[model samples]
Target: MSMTLRKRAVLAAGGLALVAALAWAFSPRPLAVQTAAVTRGLYEQAIEEDGRTRLRERWVLSAPVAGRLQRITLREGDAVAEGDTVAWLQPGAAPLLDARTERQNRAQREAAAAAVQRALATEAQARTAREQAELAERRSAQLAAQGFVSATQRDADRLNTHAARQGLEAASAAVRMAREDLVRAEAALAPPAAALPLSRAGGQAPLRLRAPHGGQVLAVPLTSETSVAAGTALLEIGDLRQLEVVAELLTADAVQARAGAPVQIDRWGGETPLRGRVRRVEPAGYTKVSALGVEEQRVKVLIDIDPDQPAAAALGDGWRVGLRILTLRQTDALQLPVAALFPRPDAPDPQGRAMAVYTVDAEGHARLRPVTLGGRNGQQAWLRDGLAAGATVIVYPPAGLTEGARVQARTP
Candidate 1:
C-alpha cells in the first residue's frame, strides 16, 4: 500500500512541472518603450519659412528728357542729401544731314520764303483798306455831327470802319506768323553747328537731375556716359532704416496667418533672434515650382521689424533671414511630445480621422487611448481632451504594442 501511493504522487508532481514550463514559455513578455511625461505649458503653433528684408520705400530716378547723360561718380551705398545733383545731361547732338537731305531742306526754305512774301502782300493790302475805311468813318462822323448827312449813312460808315479794324488786326497777326515761319525755314537750312554748337561754351546749358529725398544710392543702371531717352532709369535710392521682411509661405500656411501675429527672425548673421509682427498677408497666391519639381501655390507675408529693438538697427536691406510666424498661441495648455501620437486604425470617430497614443499607467502597463488634439508645433502638441498632466505616454510605440500590454520604461 505505501509503494503504490508514492508512485502516484511522483507522477502527478512531474505532470504539474511540465504544464508550468509550457505556460511560462508561451506567456507574452513586456515591451520596452520610450516615454515622456505630459505637462502643462505654453503652446504655440508656428510656420517656419525663409524670408528677405527690403526697404519700405524705394525711389527710382529717371531721365526727365532725352539727352546725353554724364558719367555718374556716385557708387552704391553712398549717402546723398535732398536736392543733391545725381546726374548731368547735355542737349543731344543734332542729326547729321546727307547731301540729298540738305538739298531738300534748301528747297523747303525757298518755298517758305515765297509763302512769306505772299502773306506780306495780303497783309499790306488789308492795312491800306483799313486806313481808307478809317478816313471815311471820320468824315461820316463829322458830317453827322453837322447834320448834313442822314443817320443811316453815318451808321453804315461806322460799321465799315469797325469791320476794317478787325481785318487789320487779323492781318497784323498773319504778318507775325509769316515772320516766325520764315525764321523756322532758315533754321532748317542752316548747319547743325548754328543750332547746337560742338563746343561746350557755345552749346545749350546742361540739365541737372537732383535727388528728391535723402537716402543711400541703391543702384545705378547706367554704367557709363551715354545718350539716354526720356523716362530711362538712372539710379535707385532708398533709406535702409525702414526695412521690412517678406516671407513666401505656402498658401495653406498663409491662410492661417493674420495681422499682428508675433514673429521671430533668425539666421540673419546675428547672435539673437529679432522680434517682428505680421503686417500683411497678400491677397493673391501665385504658382511656384518647388525644388522637388512639384507645382505649389504660394503667398507672401510681410513682417514689420520692431523699430525699438536693437536688432532692427543692425539689419539692412536685402538681408536673408529665417521667419517663424506664430499662427496660434495658448498661455496654458496640456502638451505631449508629437512623436507619441499615432493615427487610429479601423473606424475613426465622427471627425473621419482620430489620433491616439500608448499611455503608460501607474502599474507600468501600456494602454491605447484616443486623444483630441488642438494646436501642434514642431516639438509638442496641445491636448484638448483624453489626457492629463503628469501622465506618461510612449513615444514611437512598437508595432506589436496593444491595449493592456506590459511595458518597461527606457532610460533617457
Candidate 2:
C-alpha cells in the first residue's frame, strides 16, 4: 500500500510540472518599449523655409536719348561713384529726307537766314534810334536847365529814351531766336556722316551717361558700341551692403509670421548661422507649382540681414539660404519629444490637436493618456494637458501593444 501511494504522488508531480511548463510557454510576455520622461522647459515654434538674398534696391541705368552708344569700358562688379561717367553717346544720324522734305527744309533754312538778317537790321536801327533818343534827352535836359525847354518836354524825352532801349533789347532777342531756328533747320539737313556742332548737341561737348548712384555693376547689357534707342537698359547696379533675404512662404504661414519677428539664417555656406529680422510680409500672394505639382499660394517675406553680423559679409545677391522664422515661444511649458506622441483614435479637434501617448504606470503597464497639444516644432511638442511633469511615456510603442499591457524598459 505504501509503494502504491508513493508512485501515485510521483506521477501526479510529473504531470503538474508538464502542465506548468506548457502554461509558461503560452503566457503573454511583457512588451519591451522605449520611454521618455516628460519635462518642463522652453518650447518654441518656428517656420523654416528656403530663401535667397536680394538687393533691397536695384538701379537700372538706361540710355537717356536715342543715340549711338559708345563701348562700355566698365565690366560687371566694377565699383562706381555717384555721377560717374559710364558711357558716351553721339546723337543718331538724321533720317534720309524725301525730295519734298529736303526742299522744305532748304526753304525753311533760307527763310531763317533772311529772318536773321532782318532781325540784325532791325536791331541796328533800334540802336541808332536809342542813341538819338539819348542825345535828345541830354540836349532837352540842358535846354530845360537853360530855361529854353519845358520840364514836361524833358520828361517825355527821358521816356522816349527808355522805350528805345527796350526796343533794342527785344530786337537782340529776336536775332538770337532766329539764329536758333536756322541752326535747327541746318540740323534737319545734316547728313549721317556730318558731325554736329556744340550748339546742335544741347551746347555740351559730348553726351555722357552717368551713374545715378554709388554701387557695383550687376549687369551690362551693351558692352560694345551700338545704336540704342532712348530708355534702353544699359547696366544694372545695386549696393551689396543692402542685401536682404526673400523667403516664399505659404500664405497660411505668412499670415502668422508678422513683421518684426526675429529670424535665423542658416545653410548659407558659412561657418555660423546669421541673424536677421523680418522687414515686411508682402500683402500679395502668388500661385506656385510645388515640386510635387501641387499648386500652392505663397507670399514673400522680406528679411533684413543684421549688418552687424560678420558671417553675412561674404553673402551676395541671389545666394540660397535657409530661414527659420520664430512665430511663437514659451519659456516654461510641458514639452515632449514628438516621437513620444501618436495620433489618437478619437475625433480630432478643429486644429487637429487631438493626440495621445502611452504612459508607463507604476505597475509597469502602458496606460493610454490623451493629451491636448499646443505648439509643436521639428523635434518637440508642447502639451497643454493630460500629462504631468516627470511622467514616463513610451517613445515608440511596439505594434499590438494594448492599454494596460505590461511593458519593460528596452535594453540599450
Candidate 3:
C-alpha cells in the first residue's frame, strides 16, 4: 500500500510539470517598434515645386519695314549698345508688270493727260470772261461818274465783275490741281527706275534696326539674306543679370502662397541652395496636363532671388531649379516626426479627422494618446496639444498594437 501511494504522488508531480512547460512555451512576447523623441525647435511648413529662371525684362527686335534684309553678322551672346544699328534692310525692288498691266497703266495715264488739257482750256475761257467783265465794269464806273449810266445798270456791272473775279480764282485752283494730276500720270507712264543700293537710293538711307537698350543678343531667328515684311521678328535681347524664378503651383496650393514669403532654391547644380522671396502670385490660372494624364489648374508664382546670395551671380536666365516656399513658420514649437502620428478610430474631430500616437512609458509599454495637430511640414508635424517635448513615441507602429501593450524600442 505504501508503494502504490508513492507512485501516485510521482504521477501527480509529472502532470504538474508538463502543464507548466506548455504554458511557458506559448507565452506572449513584447512587440518591437521604432521610436523617436519629441523636441522643441524652429518649424517651417513649406511646399516644394519645380521652377525656372527667366529674364525680368526681354526685348524682341522686329523688322520696321518691308525690305530685303542684309545677312546678320551678329551672333548670339554679342554685346550691343543702345542706339547702335543691329541690322540693315535695303528697299525692296518693285514687282515686275505683265504686258496687260502695262497697257492698262498707259491707258489710265492718257486719260489723266486728256483731263488736264480740258481743265487748262476751261481756265483759259474763264480768264477771257474775267477780262471782258472787268472792262465793262470800268466803262460803267466812268459813265456813272458822268451821269451817263443809271444807278441800277452800274450796280449790275459791278456784280458781274465780282462774279468774274471769283470764277478766275476757282479756275486757277483747278489749274494747279490739274498740274499735280499731270505729274502723277507722267510718273505712272515712266518705267520703274533701276534698283539702287541702300547707300545711294536717292539720298534715302536703308532701314537701320537699332538696339533700344544695352543687352546681350539672345537669338537671331533670321540669319540668311532674305526679304522680310514689316514687324517680322529678327532678334531677341535681354540682360541676364536681372533674373527671376517662375514656379507653377497647383491652384489649391497657390491660394496659401503670398507675396514676400520666404523661398529656398535648390537643385541648380550648386552645392548650397539659394534664397529667394515670393514676388507675386499670379491671379490667373492656366490648365496643365500632369504626368499622370490628369488635367490640373496651375498658377504662376514669381520669386526674386536674393541679390546678396553668391548663387544669384552664378545663375543665368532659363536655368532649371527647385523651389521650397515657406507657407507657415513657427518658432519654439512642439514638434515630432510625422511618421509617429496615425489616424484614430471612432475619434473624428470637428475637422473631420483625428490623430493619435503611441507613446512609450518608462517600462517600454505603448499607450495610445490623442493629439491635436496644428500644422505639418513634409517630414515633421507641429503638436498643438496632448504631447510635450522629451516624450518618446513609436514611429510607424506595427499592426495589432493596443493600449498598454508591451513594446521594445529599436535603436537607429
TM-score of each: 0.68, 0.71, 0.69
Q: Worst 10-residue stretch by lDDT in candidate 2?
A: 195-204
lDDT of 1 at 286: 95
Q: What lDDT would each prediction earn against the true structure?
A: 0.82, 0.84, 0.82
Error of 3 at 333 (Å): 1.7
Per-residue accuracy of model 2 over 168-272 as CA lDDT, tens digit each: 766765676577667667866776445354645454345676776678999999999999986799988877877889999999999878876778999999989
What is the descending lDDT order?
2, 1, 3
Which window of 10 residues has the lowest lDDT sum in candidate 3?
192-201
Per-residue alpha-carbon lDDT of model 1 for 1-412, expressed as tens digits?
8999999999999999999999998998778899999999899889999999998667777775468999999989899986789999786665678999889878977887887788888888988998999999899889889998887577556555655665665565555556655665675566766753355567667777777557799999997999998669999987676678999999999988887677999999989999877878999999999999999999999987766577677777898999999888888899999999888785476652368999999898999899888867789989899988999999999998889989998877
Task: Give one clash count per candidate, in the order shown.
Answer: 0, 0, 0
Candidate 2: segments with Cα more than 4 A from true spot? 1-13, 94-205
Best by TM-score: 2
* Poorly placed runs, candidate 1 (over 4 Å): 1-27, 93-200, 346-353
* Clash pairs (backbone) in predicted model 2: none
Model 3 over residues 1-412: C-alpha lDDT tens digits?
9999999999999999999998888878889899999999999988899999998667777764467899999999898976678998875654567899779877867887888888889889999999999999999999999999987577666656755665665566566556555554564455445333335537435666777556799999999999998569998887666678999999999988887777899999889999877878999999999999999999999987766566577787798999999999899999999998888786867662269999999998899999988888789999889988999999999899999999998766
Report how far off residue 177 is in candidate 3 (Å): 39
**Model 1, 390: alpha-carbon shift in Å?**
0.8
